[model samples]
Target: MMTKLGPLLLVLLLAGPESSCGDNPRYEKFLRQHYDNPKSSFSGKYCDSIMAKRGLTKPECKEVNTFIHETKNNIKAVCEEGGEPYGNLRRSKEHMKVTTCKLKGGSTRPPCKYKENSSPRYIVIGCENGWPVHYDESQIVTTVDNADLD
Candidate 1:
């Protein structure tokens, strides 16, 4: 993470378009550096405020982004969950526990809206320093895996 522009571009090219989040280690590093939850409840308003504070509100707005409260080591271990592959990106089964988030309707401009949906499901994340730093949107396997534990 916090890699130079050249390395970032290289990683993006390898990750492809679908690998929106967690494609760039810099962004992952940014998330780890700025957004780690413990203070407030992980609610919709929390997503809105954090996204804006993290500079994810520029241009249009990030429609989807997940912030995991668990330790980075636990999150990174998800990659080895033996899930299927998603395009060229690495993915895990719908077993890893996570709190998912999406922007609510009418969230188009500044002061974006977000709705927090916490559940256990297959998640894709990028790792740095042997820790999962960013959640990848392209690699989400499923949301309907009710068997996932809370």
Candidate 2:
């Protein structure tokens, strides 16, 4: 169960000090969070709008990003999912299921292309009020059982 966060764990491990942003009493809040539930229908312009709003523009476009589809409460519960401390952050752990989007095309300007990678993984997230509030860091209190994928 906890082993699922492998890929995401790797990302957190490599994340630099200034990777995420937010002020929700726990983890930094995303500039523009969106619901990426599997059943939802998103317009083709989804990335175009969100990228700008999140300040992911300027210089070069963001190469990769992720969207969680679960509720704030459900996400927070991940802290108790138990794994291992990701970094120096307090009370954080890895969760499962995320939609990762990678920039496509060679251009870094407008109309940035993107490819989606949706899967169940061990995601590193910061939690507050018994829920997850930000990503990129946290601590855990569990051990790995298996490295299965969903």
The candidate scoring highest on TM-score is 1
Q: Pick the candidate with the highest lDDT.
A: 1
User: Where does model 2 exceed 4 Å of error?
Assistant: 1-28, 34-39, 43-60, 80-84, 89-95, 127-133, 137-150
lDDT of 2: 0.54
Clashes of 2: 8
lDDT tens string, model 1, 8-98? 8888799774335545566567455334544345355777777776667778677877655544444455545553445434456545555
Stretches of candidate 1 exceeding 4 Å from the true structure: 1-30, 33-44, 79-87, 126-134, 142-150
> Per-residue CA lDDT of candidate 2, range 1-150, in tens?
668898788888887433443445335444244334442455755555555556666666777777766654455555665534455333324545566666888787755666776665666665465345566522222434354322
As for candidate 2, its clashing pairs are: 4-122, 5-122, 22-28, 22-29, 76-131, 76-132, 83-142, 92-139
Kindly state the number of residue pairs that clash in model 1.
1
Q: Which ten residues in a row have the lowest lDDT in candidate 1?
A: 33-42
TM-score of each: 0.54, 0.52
